[model samples]
Target chain A: MTEVKKTYKHYVDGKFVRSESGKVYAIDLKNEKYEIPLTSKKDLRDAVTSSKAGFTKWNSLTMYNKSQILYRLSEMIEGNKESYIILLQDHGLRKNEAKNDIENSINTIIWYAGLVDKWEQLTGNLNPVAGEYFNISHQEPIGVTFTLNSNSISLDDLVKSFLPALTVGCSVINFSEKNAVIALKLSEDINNSDFPAGSLNIIAGKFENIVEDVGGHVEIKHAAIYDDISKESKTIIGEKGSESVKRISFQPPTSGLSSILPFIETKTVWHPKGK
Target chain B: MNNWEYAESIESEKIVKIEKKYGHFINGEFVSPNSKKYLDTISPSSEEVLSSISIGNEKDVDFAVNAAKEGLKQWSKTSPSERSKYLFKLARLIQERSREFAVLESLDGGKPIKESRDFDLPQVAQNFFYYAGWADKIDLAWGSEISKPYGVVGQIIPWNFPLLMLSWKVAPALATGNTVVLKPAETTPLTALLFAELCDEVGLPKGVFNLITGDGTTGSELVNHKDIKKIAFTGSTSVGKYIQKSLAGRDVGLTLELGGKAANIVYNDAALDEAVEGVVNGIFFNQGHVCCAGSRLLVQEDIHDIFISKLEKRMQTLRVGNPLDKNTDIGAINSKDQLDKITNLVNEGVSDGGELFQIECELPKNGFWFKPSLFTGVQANYKIATEEIFGPVLTTLTFRTPDEAVEIANNTEYGLSAGIWTEKGSKILWTADRLDAGVIWANTFNKFDPASPFGGYKESGFGREGGRHGLLSYIKASS
Candidate 1:
C-alpha cells in the first residue's frame, strides 16, 4: 500500500485554500516534500479583510470563553500529538526531539490559555491620579495583527509567533516561510479548536513577497516580525508603515509579559467622583 | 438681550527676567551657536520680539549630542536615589519660581495667564515631582530588566506647552538614566531656556539635560544623529511621520505624541448645562492647541438643537484678549502662521456648506487671534471635520444611536483623546469601551495628571507620556 502525499494550502478564515495567484513553493524534507501556497500581495489583502471581521468576532467573546477556547487547542493538540510528532519527524527532527517540541508547544498553549483572562491584571492598574477622580489605565487589542514567524523549524517557535497576540484578543495573520510544514500541521489542531473563523489565519509565503503589502495595509493595525530580516526590508517596512502610523515591532519578546505589550494600546479612562 | 463685558485684571510680568539674547544650553552652560545665526522670538500677543535665540545648525546639534553622550557617562554613574534627589530639588525650584515661569510662558507662548499659572505651571511641577519618586522605585514599577535606559535621548516638544512638555520629556529621561538633548519649539523657547537655568541651579550633571533652541532643521539634525538612542517628539502628525520615516532602518527608539481629532460625545441623557460647559472646555481649552483636544462634538440627534443653542451662548461669554489678563478665557494664536492656518480652515468649512457660528468678540489689534468657532450641518467627510484644525474651532455631527455614535466617533484616523458625557454609568462604560481613543474623559474634559497615562491610538501616534507607563517611553526591556 502506498501512502498519500499531502499538499498544504494556506489556512485562512478557518478554510484551507490556495492563494489567488495559484503559486506554491516546495519544502523538501527528510521523508516527504510538501508544497505550500505562496501568499501574494492580493492574498495578504484578503487575509487582512478576514482578520478585521475575525477580530470583532474573536474579541467580542468573553475572556473566560477565550481562555477555554485556547485551552481546547491544547486538548486537540494533546489528542493529536503522535501526528504532529510524525510531521516533525518528516521535517527532519529526531523522534525524541519531535516529542519535546510538541510538549513545549502544548505547555506554551496552556500558559497562554491561563493568561488570557489575567494579562490585564498584570499589565493594567487603577491610576492613583492626584485628584478627586476615578482614573484607571487599561489596554485594548490592536486589531488585525500580522506576525511573521521566525524561520526556526520548530512547532514551539512557530506557536510563539501568534500566541502572544492571540492570547490578548488580537486577530493574528501568522505568516510562515520554510516552517510552513509545522505551522500548516498545527493549523489542523487550530481549526479543530473553537476559534473564530479568521482570528488565527496561517498563511505560507516568503515574507519578501508581501512585506510592502503588510506595511502599507492600513487595516492591519500592527506588523510584528519575529524573523530576522535584512536592513533593506526593515527600511521598507518602516517607511511604508509610517504612512498610516502603523505599529511595527522588530524581533519582539516571545515568552514574557513584554511579548504581548507591543500588540496592545493602553487606554486610560477618567471620571469625576462625586455624589 | 444682555450686553456683558469682562474687566481686564492683568497679571504682572515683573517677576520674570528675560534676556535680550539667548544661546544653546549644552554641557550645563549657555554657549553661542557655532552657526552664528539667531532668530527673533516674538510675543504673539503684542507682536513684539521677546528675544533673539540661536538658530542651531548641524554643528550646534552635534555639539549638544556629544555633550549628552558625555553627560550619559555621569548620569549612568549617579545613584538612583541621588537622581531622585536632583529631580525633587528641580520640582521644588519649579514650584518656587512657578509664577515667574508662568508669566514668561504667557509672554512667549500666548496662552492665557489663567491657564499658564494655574494649570500648566502646577502640572509641570507635579510631573517633575511624580517622576522624582519613580526614579528609585523604577525596579518596582516594572521588573529591573525593563528599566534600563536607552542612553542618549533627543526630545522635541511643541509650542503649546513649553515647560510642561519639558517636564514630560526630561523628568523621565533623567529618572530612567538617559541623558537628553532637547529642542524647544521655535515660537516658544523662552520658558524652556528659563528651565535650563533651573537645571543648572539644581546642579544636575552636565549633558544630562541639554537645550538647543532652533527651527525644524535643528530637530531634523537631532533625529538623524547616529549617537542618539531615542527620539521623543510631541507635535503635528505630519512631522511625526517625517521623523518616523527618517529613523527607518536605524536601531533607535521613538515615542510620538502627535495630532488628534477627538470626539466629545454628548448623549441625550447628559445634563444639558454641564455638557455645554464640557463641550466648550473640550475644544476651546488652550485655543484648541492641545493634541488631545476634543475637536469634534458628536451630539445625540434628539438633543442637537438645544445643545447647539446652549453651546453658542456659552461660547459667546468666553473672554478673548491679552494672555497677561487673568480674566481672559482665550488668548492670542500661538503665531501669525497658526492664526492664518485657523482662518483658512474656518473659511474652508463655510465653503464646504457647513453652517458656521463664531462668537462676537473684540480681538486685540496687534495680535493674532481667532474667535471661538462652531460648525453645524457638518458632513463627516468635510475637510474641517476630518482634518485637525488645531484651533478654537468645533465641528458638530449628529448621531441617532449609541452604536452610530461610537461608529462616528471612531471613524477618524486619530484616536488621541475623547470625551463621553452621560449621566448613566453603563452608557459611559459602553461608549468608552467602544471608542478607540487613548484617553477617555467621562463627564470632564481636558483634565491632566502626571499619574494618568496619555498618548494616542492610530495615526495620532504611539507610546504614552504620563504615569507608570511614561517611564516605558524612556526605557527598554533588557530582553
Candidate 2:
C-alpha cells in the first residue's frame, strides 16, 4: 500500500485555502528548497477583516486572560523547540545560535505576556484638575501593524518584533524576509497554537514593490522595517507609510537582539478597596 | 590689499599670550589636579596655542563625581522656584559681562567675534532664561503625575558651539534638579571655565555644577564613573557608538546628539527665491559646523539646471573673509583638521567624476577657511554625498517626483534634520511626512526655538535636545 502526501495552505479566517491569486513561492533554505504557500492580497483582506471582527471582544478581555493565552503560546513554542531549531539552521544560523534564537523568541513572548496588566503604570497616570469631573489616561494598542522582517535573522527578529505588538492586542501582517523558510515554518507553528486565525498573517514577495503597497494601506495603523539600506530607502518607506499617518519605526544599525521589556507599557488598574 | 595679506595683519595685531597652568572645578572651586597631565588648546583659525588645560584623569573625574553627588542632595531638595531665580540671576550677570566671555571664547576657540557676540554668548544666556521658566513650571511639562531627577549626570560637549552647547546641557539638567559634572572639549574649555566662575558669583550651591577639562580619555573616565547616574554627549557618531558599547551591560541613562548628513529637498514648484535663501542657510550657517545642517540638496529634475545656477551665483556674493566682520556671511572653518577633511571630501567628489561649483571668491591664507562649495551630478554612493563633511560643502542631486525626492532625502544613516520648499501647503505636509529626519522645515531653513523639539534619528544619535522632550534626559521615569 502506498501512502498519500498532504499539502497545507494558508490558515486564514479559521480555514486553510489556496491563495486566490494562485501564487506560490519556493522557500530556499540553503541547499534544500521547498514550496511554501503564501497569502494573496485577497487572503490578506480576509485576514484583516477577521482580525477587525475579533479585536473588540479580544481587547475587552481581562489582562489576566490575555496573558494566559500568550503564556500558552510560549509553552507551545517551547514544546516545538527541536523543530524550530531545524528551521533556524536551515535559514543559515549556526547550531548554538539557532538554539539561542529559539530560546530568545520564547523569552520575548513571555516577557510581553507579563506586561499585559501593567501598561498604565509604566506609561503614566492623568492628573485630576480642580474642576474636572473625571480624568484618566491609558495606552491602547495602536492597531494592525505591518512588519518587515530583516533578512539576517528571519525567525528570531520577526518573533521579537511581532510579540510586543500582539501582547498589546494589535494584530500583525508580517512581511517575511526573502528566503525565510524557517520563518514560514515558525508561522505554521503559530497557526497550530491557540492564536485566533488571522491574528497573525505572513506574506512573501518582492520587497520594493510590495513595501509601498503595504505601507500605503489604510488598515495598517503602524509599520516597522528592520532592513539596513540607504537613506533614500528610508525616505520612500516613510513617504509610503505617510498616506495613513502610520506610526513608523526604523530599527537602527545596532543589533536588534536587545531585550525590549523596558519599552513595553504596563497598565495597572486600581480601584477603591472599600468598594 | 588682498584678503590674505589683510587677514595676516589682523592675526599679528591680536598678540594674545597662551597660558600653561589650569585646574579642575570641583565643589564650586578650582582645585589643583592630582594628575598633572594637560591638553593644549589651540586656535583653529591660527593654529596658535591659546592655553594648556589640565586634563581630568580618572582621579579628577572621581573628585568631580563625588562633588556632584554631594551637590545633588541639597540642589534636588531646593524648590524649583528657587532654582529658577538662581538661573535668572546668572543669565543677567552673564549678559552684563558678555564682552569678556565673547573675547575669551574667540581667543581660545577661533570663532569670529560676531558669532561670539551674536550666537554663542546670546544663545547661552537665552538657554538659561528659557530653561529658568521651566524650572518652576516643570510640573506642567511632564505629562506624568510625578517627575524625579536622575542624580549626578555626566555630560561631554563638543567644540563647535562651546557655550551654547554647554547651556543646552547644563540648563535643562540643573532645572530638573540633576547635578552635573561637565567636560568641555579639549580645544575649547575657556567659556565653560568662565561659566563655572559665574556659577559661583550667582551663589549656586557648592558641588551643584563641576567643570572638568579634557580630551576623549577624560570624557571616558567621567562616562565610566561609578557614581554617574546618566550620560549626555554631543559629538561624532563613532564616539557615540563607543559610549553605547561601554554602557551595554549597565543601566546608565544616555542621550547622544551626534553626527549628521542631512538633506535639503527643492521641488520645481518651490518658491525659488526663498529656496535660494534656504540653500545658503542650510550649508553655510555656522560655517557648516552644525550637526543638523542640511549638507545634501536634492532638487527636482525640472528645476535642477536653473536652481544650481542661481545657487552658485548667490554663493559667489557671500562674504567669506573674516568672521569678526559684521558683514561676513560665512566664517572660517572651525579647525584646521576640519578644514582638511572638507577639502579632501570635495576633492574626492571631483575625483569620483562629479563637477565642482566653487563660489569664485578668494579665501584668507592665514586662518583655516574654505569657500563654500557645491557638487552636482553626483551619485548617491559618492563619498561627498554619503559622508559628513562638517564644513561649508554641499552636494546636489536631482529627483523627478515627490517620492523620488523623499527616497533621496532619507538615504543616509543620519536622520538629523531636513528642509522642504514648495509653494503648496499640502505638498509641504506631504514632503515632511516622507522625510525620515527628526526636524522638518517647511519653506524655511535653520529656524530654531526653545518651544520646538529638536533631535536626530538613527546614527545621527538618539534623544532630543530642545523643548519639553529635551527635559527627558534629566528626569528618571522610575520615580
Candidate 3:
C-alpha cells in the first residue's frame, strides 16, 4: 500500500476552516493526485477582514522593526529550500527548474529585505523652496491589496507580489495559483515567523470565478490580475473590479519571474536637531 | 448684395496684425531668453510672420527646470487647502479674462472664434475648477492612501488647442502637488506667454510654473533633462514614438497623449438627423485637427447614401472664414505645412479612384484654407483611411453588420476614441465592448468632461488624463 500526502484547509484569522462551498480542485503530480481545498467567497472575505484588522498595528511598527521581521521571513524561506523544491516539482517543474524557482523565490524576499530601509530614501524627500518653512514629502501605504498570483512559477510570483507590499507594511489578501501547494507551505512558514495573523493570507481556488467574487467585494482597495488570458476575461475582471473602483494593474505578457517593487509612502520626520 | 454677403465682404477688407518679440516666462516674470536666438512663427492662415518668439535652447530649459525644482519643495509642503485656493484663483482669473484668451488663441492657432470662446476657453476653465476640488481631496483619489507628487514635471503642448492643452497639463500637474516646466508649441506661443502674465497677476509663487517656448530641439532638450522626473506630451504619433525610443532605458516616467485616426460608425437604425449632426461635429470640429476627432465615418451600407447626403448638405451650411468671426464653423489650418499635407492626402484619395465630394463652398484666397472634403468608396486599406489627415477630411466606408462595423473600427493602429450611433441599447453596449479605443461614445461625438478619463490604446499612446486616473500620471503608483 502506497502512502498519500494530505492536503489541508486554508488558515484565516488564526483558524483553519474548510471551504463553505464544499468544493476542491485536484492537484496532479505525475502519476499521483491529491485533493487541494478551494477557498470560498466567505473565506476570501474573512481573509480581507483579518488583514484589515492587522494593518493598523503592522503599519504602526517602526521601519527598522518591519525590516527585521521581513529579514526573518527570508531566512526561514531560505532554510526550507528542499521542501519548497519538492513542492515545485510536484507542480510539473523538472528538478533543475524547481531549484531555479526556489532560488528565485527566496532571492525575491531577500531583495525586499535589503530594500526595507532604502524605501524612504528612494520615495520621500524635502523640497527646496525660496521660503521660511520646510517642506517634506512622504510615501504612505495603500491598505489591503487583493493580489492574484500568476500561473507561471507560482511560488516565486506569489512571493514577488507579497513581499514588497508586506515590506512596506500593507497587509495582503492573496489568491495564489490553483496548483500552488508550495505557496500554501510558504504561508505556513510565514505564520511561524514573527508575521502576525492577517498580515498575510493565502487562498487557492478557481481563477475566474474566485477572482470575480473577490473583485466584487468593496473592501479590496486594489487588485492585480496576474495571468495571460483572453480579452473577454480582462474585460470581465476590469468591470468586476469597477464595483469598488479598485486600483488595477494588468501585467503584460513577458513580465519576468521577478518581483516588482511597488511605491509606498515613507514619511520622514525632521526636527531642528541642533536647537 | 445681400446683408450677409456685404458683412462678409467688409470683414475681408481688414488685415489682422501679428506681434513680434515674445519673451520667456521664468521665475514669476516675463524675462529675456537665456539665449538671444529667436524663431519666426508664421501665421498659417496668410503665410505671414505672426511673431518672433524667443527660442529657448537647452540653457533656457535648464533654467526653467531649476526654477521648477526650487519651487517644488515649497509648493509640495503647502496644505492641500492652500494649494486648492491657488488653483481656484487661477481658474477664476482664466474665466474673467476668457475673451482675451479666446481671441489670442484664435490669432495664434487659427481656430475659429466660436470654438475658442465656447468650447476651448470654457473647458480650460472647467479643467482647472475640477482639479481644484481634487487638490484637497487627493486622499480620496488614491486607493485609501495619501498621494504624493512627482518632482519637476516637463510638459510639452501641441498647437491644435494651445491654451486648452496647456490647461489640461498644468491644472492636474499642479493639483497633484508637482511643479511644472511647460513648453508651448512654438507656432502658438502667444496665449501661453499671456497665461504666464496671468500667473504673475494672481501672485502664484515664483518658480512654480515656467513656460519655455521653442520647437523640437527645445522639446528634446527638456525631455532629456536629467533632473526632470516625468514628461507629459500631447502631439504627433511620430514625435511621440521618437520620445519613447529616446527614453527607452531611462527612469524618466512618461505620459503621451498623441495622434489618432478615430472611427465614427453610423448604423441604419440611427436617428438620421442626429447622425448627421454627429458626423458634422465629428469631422469638422476644430477643423478636424483634434487628436480624437472622428476622421473615418463607418456607415452601415443600408444608410450610406442618405447619411452622406445629409452630411454634405450640413457641410455646405458651415461658414469657413476669418477665425475671429463669431459665426465661423471652419477656421484656417494651423500652419501652411498642415494645409499642404491636407491637400496632398485629399489628392491621393482622388488619384486612388475614390469619389471626391467637396462642400461646394468657396475658400478664402488669402488664408491657409481647404474646403471640407468627403471620399466615397474608400477602402479600409486606402492611405486616406489609414493615416491621420488632421484636417477637415472624412473618409467614408460601409460595413454590412455590427461585427463588421467593429472590425473596420478596430482596423487602425490608433485607438484614441470611437463613436457609435444606434438606437438599440444592446448593440450600443456590444459595440462599446468590442471597440479597442479608450473612449466609446453613444448618440454623441466629441463630448468631454474633466470627470471623464481620456487616453488612447496601442500606438495612439499610453496613460490617461482627467478623472482619478489623471492623478495617477503625476504621482508614482505606490506613494
Candidate 4:
C-alpha cells in the first residue's frame, strides 16, 4: 500500500491556510502526487501585512534570543536531515545531490544562526566623533523583506537568502515558484521551531503576482530577488516601488559580512558623555 | 519680557576680503570655467553681492571630473601616512584661519557668527581632524576585509551647512584615497572658495581635490558624468530620486543625505524645561535649514499646554538680526527662494486650521529673513507637519500614548533624525527603537560628530555619511 501524500498550503500569519482564491496546483515528483496552493495577489497582500507585524515582534527580541531561536531551527532541520534528503531525492535530486542539498541547507542555517548575535560588532562601531557625545552606530534590521526565488533554484539557495535576512531580525515573505513543496516543508520546520508566527511566510505561486503586490506595499522596506526572474518584472517592481524608496536589488549577497548587512540599516544614537 | 534690549555686538567682517569674481578650483588652482558664466553669491543678511562664482556647465564638469580622475591615480597611490598628513595640514590651517572662515560663513551663509565660529567652523575643523586619523587606518575601520577606494567622487552639498557639509564629504573621500570634484551651492560659495585657497596653501598635490561652483544644472552634470565613480549628494528628496533614477543601470556608487521632517517627542515624565530647550535648538538651529532638524513637536496631551507656553516664551527671546552679530540668536534665512517656500508652507498650515505663533521682532530690511514661527493644534496630515519646510518653522502635534507618538512619528515619508525627551530611560530606548529615523538623539538635538553615521531611511535617502560606515560609502570591499 502507498503512503498518503501530504497536502501543502501557504504559510501566512503563523498558520497554514489555503489561498484566498481556493486554487490548488499539483506537483508531480517521481510520479508521486503533491498539491501546492496557488497563492494570488490578495494572498501576497495578506502575507506582507502579516510579515510586517511579525517584524515588530521578532525585532524586539534581544540578539541572544534571536540567535537561540535560529540555532534551534537549524537543529530541528539537522535532526530531520534524513527525511529532507528523502524529500529532495523524491523531488528529482540524485542521491548525492539530495544529500548535498540537505547538508548545505542545514549548514547555511547554522552559519547564519551563529552570526545572528555577532553581526552588529562586525558592522557597527563606537565612533570617536570628536566631541563630548558618546556616539555609536548599531546595525538594525530594515523591517519586513520580500524575497523571490526562481523556479529552478535549489532549496539551499532559497535558504541562503531567507536565513541571512532572518538572522538579521527581518521577517521574510518568500515566494518560491519552482520548489514550493520543499519550501513549505521548511516553513513547517520554522513554525514548529522557536520562531514566532508570521516570521517566515512561504507562498507558492507565480512570481509576477507576488512581485506586483509587493510593489504597492509601502511596509516592505527591502526586496531580494534572484536574478533568474525576468528583467521586466524587476523593472516593474522598481518603478512601482519607487514612491516609497523601496530598496530592490537583484544582487543578493551570497556570503560574508555584507550578506546580512543588506538586510539591515545603520542607526546612530547620540547622547552627551558628560561627567 | 525684557523692557530693554541688549546692545548690538556685531562681529567685524573686515578680517576677510570679498572678491568681485571667483573662479572654480581645479587641479590645485583656481581656473575660469569652460562655461565662462558667473552667478553672484550674496550675503543673505546684507543682500550684498559677496562674490560672483563660476556657473559651470557640462564641459566644466567634464574638466573637473578629468582633473579628479588624474588626481585619483596619484591620490590612490599615495601612502596612507601622506594622505593623513595632508588632511591634518588642512585641518590645522582651517583652525588657524577659523575666524576668517567664520566671518565668511556668516556673510555668505547667513548663520550667526557665534554658530559659524562655535559650531560650524569648529565642527568643520574637527571633521577634518577626525577623518585625518582614519586616513592611515581605513583598512581596519570597516571591520571587514581590506577595502579599495572608488575613484573620482562627485559631491554636491546644500547651502545650509556649506563648509561643514564639504568637510563631511571631502575629508572621508580623500581619507579613503579617492580624488574629489565638489560643487558648492549657488547661494553660498564663499567659504568653499576660501577652503580651496587653503588647499593650495597646504601644497596638496595637483588634481587631488577640485571644487566647481554652480547651480543645480552643474550638479546634474556631475551626477550624470560618465567618469565619476561615485556620487555623494546632500539635498532634497525629489532631486535624490532623480539622481537615483539617472544612475539606474550604472555600477557607480551613490550616497544621498536628503531632506527630513523629523519628529521631536516629549513625554509627560520628561524634564519640561530641558525638553523645551531641546525643541528650540532642534528646529531653530541653522535657521531650520538643517536636514535633520526636529520640525514636528509631539507632546503628550497632559503637558501640551504648559509645553507650548514655555516653548513660545523661549522662542520670544531669540534675537533675529544681522548674522555677524555675536548677540544675534536667529539669523537671516538662507535665501529669498527658501524664505518664500517657508512663507507659503506656513500660510498653508494656518489655512489648514492650525494655530500660528510667531516671535515679534524687528528685522533687517535688506536681506532674507522670516520670523521663527510655530503652528500648534496640528493634525498628522497637515502639510506643514508632513513636509520639510526647511526653515525656522515648527508644527506641534499631540498624542495621548507612547504608541500613538511612535505612529505619528513614523508616519512621514522621511526618517532622517528624531529626538526623544524623557527622564525615563526605558522609554527612551523603547521609543528610539520604534522610530524609523536613522539618528536618534536622546535629550539632545542637532548634535553631530564626524564619528556618527548620519543619514536616513525611506525617502530621506540611503547610505551613512560619517563614522566607519561612512568609509564604506567611498570604498568597495572585495568578496
User: In the order shown, what is each candidate's alpha-carbon RMSD?
Assistant: 1.7, 13.3, 15.3, 3.2
TM-score of chain A of each: 0.97, 0.79, 0.85, 0.93
- Among all windows of 10 consecutive residues in model 1 chain B, the one with the lowest summed lDDT is B1-10
Candidate 2 Cα outliers beyond 4 Å, as residue runs: A1-275, B1-20
Worst 10 residues of 3 chain B by lDDT: B9-18
lDDT of 3 by residue, A1-275 (tens): 32346676665655555677778876666545666668777778778889898776677778888878888887887888888787777777888898887787777777777777776555444533222323233445656777776766556777776666776677787676565566667767777777677777777777666666665666665565665545655655555654333445555111221123232422221111121
lDDT string, candidate 4, A1-275, tens digits? 33338779888988999999998887777746677888887888898889988998888888899888888888888888887888888877887998887788778878888898888878887877666877788878888998886455366787886887888899999888768888898888888787777788889877766666676588888888854666677666765666666776676667777677678788988877654
Q: Please, what is the whole-model Cα lDDT of each candidate in the order they appear? A: 0.93, 0.72, 0.76, 0.86
CAPRI quality of model 4: acceptable
- Give lDDT for model 2: 0.72
The segments of candidate 1 whose C-alpha lies over 4 angstroms from its true place after superposition are A1-4, B1-6
Q: Rate residue B221 of model 2 by lDDT.
A: 98
> What CA RMSD would candidate 2 show?
13.3
TM-score of 4: 0.92
Off by over 4 Å in 4: A1-9, A16-40, A83-94, A129-131, A150-153, A178-182, A204-216, A226-235, A273-275, B1-5
Worst 10 residues of 1 chain A by lDDT: A1-10
| Per-residue lDDT of model 1, residues A139-161, tens digit only | 89999999999978688888899
Sort order, lDDT high to low: 1, 4, 3, 2
- Each candidate structure's TM-score, on Cα atoms with residue i matched to residue i, is 0.98, 0.68, 0.68, 0.92
For model 2, chain A alone compared with the true chain A gives a TM-score of 0.79
Tens digits of per-residue lDDT for model 2, B1-479: 65654332132224333346678899999988878888777666666777778888999999999999999888978999999998898889889877778767776666667777777888778778888888887666654433578888999999888988998999999998999999998888988888888899999999999999988899999878888888999999888867765654355777778888888889999889879988899888888888988899989999998998899888988877665555666767767678888888899899999999888777777778888889998998999999988888899988999998898888877777888888876887677655666666676677554444566655666566766666766774432
